[model samples]
Target: MRLYTKDEIQHAVRLNTTVIDGIESAFTSLKTKKVAMPPIMRIDIPANNGEVDIKSAYIEGYDSFAVKLSSGFFNNPKLGLPSANGMMILISTTTGEPQAILADNGLLTDIRTAAAGAVATKHLSREDSRTVGIIGTGSQAKYQLEALTHVRPIDQVQVYGRSREKAEQYKSFIEKSLNMRVDIKNTPSEAVNNSDIIITTTPATEPVLKAEWLNEGQHITAMGSDAEHKQELDTNVLEKADLVVCDVKEQSLILGELRSCSNSKLINQVHELGEITSGLKPGRTGYNQITVCDLTGTGVQDTQIARYAYQQLNFKEDDYNE
Candidate 1:
């Protein structure tokens, strides 16, 4: 049928538009009014000094199926290859036919994740938010910053990372690109101490930001914890949060920040991000409220994005038949 490279998808889909649309569609599906998104299945394959993960998901209402195959590409340093590589496949739901292929798994994933953050920010962050803090300095960190900037003024940014070099590099990149001053902080505490909005995108096994480091009137988006042993915030931080919303409650409880605090029943009253998106539940009650949105990542997002890619391709039976 039709094919779309990562560049084409980037040109065709705008971050804010795609994100807002995906959130609305996904939440509508989750409410059981329309849409059908099955759980995502992932397979990890060990490679030469690294591993690759293949993920597959399906959305019913959109009449499409998608499979994302990507790798960590950690061996790039020793093998002279990129650190990450992958692609996605979109299949027509009407006739179970192949529709389109996209070769930028990383880019697609980043946009969807950022969009999820935007949705959370729109619902949870205070209307007066201006300053933002980012606790990682990688590719995903850039998208996170860009997505937040699209939603808020973000006059000031505080960046923290394990590597001072990378942190400064990220700061320079964003400042030059966004034309906004980015303050490079030496420590995670420094980044979160006085920020109005915070985003954590690290792969730390232990807590990096302590509960005491946070202030009132702040919103936190924890986007790095996607596996069982990954965590970026102190369990006590979650306990102190005024409200904790997750992309999916079941997935978060198993692999997100909720896993770290499982020993205690402190996160019992958690709500899903979809519920907040649907307006079924209230977001931030006041400017002083402490809100946390734990995004463990979900297949529903992949499904919705895949559908968007298919529409962009303008797939038709004639193209396939030819």
Candidate 2:
């Protein structure tokens, strides 16, 4: 088996149209091909403000599958370490042998997660979406914006973060890298009021974005809630949406914004994003409709992205000492 480091994986995989298409295809396969993806296994370490999630899946036509382990330690920055890091192990489907070890250090997860956000925005948001509201200043805040540019005609950005320094840093990076107009807002409501599309990338256990802050023709993508206690959107936000979508309905109900949603009828009406991608369900039926997509991350994304990364790199047996 081949072993690849984070640098090698980062060199091969990037958040671009091709990578976005690969993730979009994974959602399509999830709906049409009925890929077997198990429930996410989670381990929480409250003492260190950390959590580890294990995800895996088997796609029908793929030669290999991926079992990914990703961790998030919110206090890592204080220790001079990244908040998120992990790796992926690819196992052969036919012979049950290991194919490769992608020591991506969570780069693949970050890319695929943002790519999934892009896919959701492409299908669920308005065709004329140009202005975006960002509700966090973390790495995902940057990656999600980069991914959105591929699908929407995004030109303006409004940001709201708990830290002024980090928010300013985010604004500076965005203006320099994306060449877009970015303004830092004092509150989340201020950011939400001015955008056609809003993305929440925080890991707060309490609600960050309120339902009253949402408006007609606005699409919201809440991607920070991957654990049972984590939340980003107020429960009422889901109730007010004209349509609510998720990467996987089952996972969403357990680990996403839907977990806070207590309305039984609304839960039944929720649609999986894959169904919309596969053309089984309609998306954004009306120009004035309010839409929301809750992404909890998925293993199908890991499998497809891992495969894509492997295919893009050149492997040599001499590179690693056995």
Candidate 3:
């Protein structure tokens, strides 16, 4: 019966090793523990250029599970509002009753998504990777970069956005907050070229990155294609990658980059991130190999992050019981 606001949750959860490891552990549990995670339920509001996604998961041995509701209204920024917002509810397993309502206003989603990217990079990307290429200048663009610093020795950044003004703003934010050098690129190709780790965060319905732009020994994280119509990488990019991984195989086939790919053989070759994280399969077998991880977000991440945030707050149930 604990109700927490976004401000309270923000102070409790942050982008740190502890948070990153918690998310990584969720991935591990997905494979080893067989987490009961259902597919994401989405409702599209085409008239408003927005979509709402409902996700939830029940992990074994957990005292509580999380049900998260998050929305993305692409046109919100035009009205000076954020594009992402929502909340999560924690329900106890034993009692089958509500435990806590985490009204994080999508902050938990943002953090967990960014943490998932960091986990992908930590296990797949090269240890020596430093330079980063970011596509799309949004909240995620900044968050993705911030999360990368925790996993990689990132020092340089290149960014490409449709809006020059937003790109400039993002550059300033990164330079001031992370103290890293950032260069604005005229095209996605320009931004991706020569970068050790390339992250695509746009909500584009078309491919913003091409296969020809990719280089050997580089890692790419494609996280924007959480919908069936949204795609950031050319289908050829996935085909060309030496190793292609996904947050979930079935979900990726329906909602991620795999949904756009035509090659059935390539789709069959795709592996789940849990496989790599659980050590059942190898990650980055060669330093020169190209790796691509497609993340469409996952319910297990919500369950884990919500639980972690609740624990971090040091809540006492009796004090807030209704």
- For each candidate, give its TM-score against the true structure: 0.90, 0.95, 0.95
lDDT of 1 by residue, 1-322 (tens): 6677777677666677556667556754665555444444555555554555556655455678677766665568677777777777877778978877877657888888888888888889998888898899988788888888777778889989989999889988998988888998988999997899999998788988789998998999999998777898898889889998888887888789998776455666888887877778889988789999999877667767777766655544335578
Encode model 3's per-residue lDDT on 160-261: one tens digit a residue.
999999999999999999999999999999999999999999888999989999999999999998887789889989988999999998988888999988
lDDT of 2 by residue, 1-322 (tens): 9899998888777799999999999999998885889888889999999989899999998999999999989899999998888999999999989888999998898899999999999988999999999999988999999999999999999999999999999999999999999999999999999599999999889999999988899999999998788999988999889999999988888889999888999999998988999899998998889999999999999999998888776543334533
| Regions of model 1 farther than 4 Å from truth | 34-38, 47-49, 313-322
RMSD of each: 3.2, 2.6, 2.5
Pairs with backbone N, CA or C atoms under 3 Å apart (clashes), candidate 3:
none
Write down the TM-score for model 2: 0.95
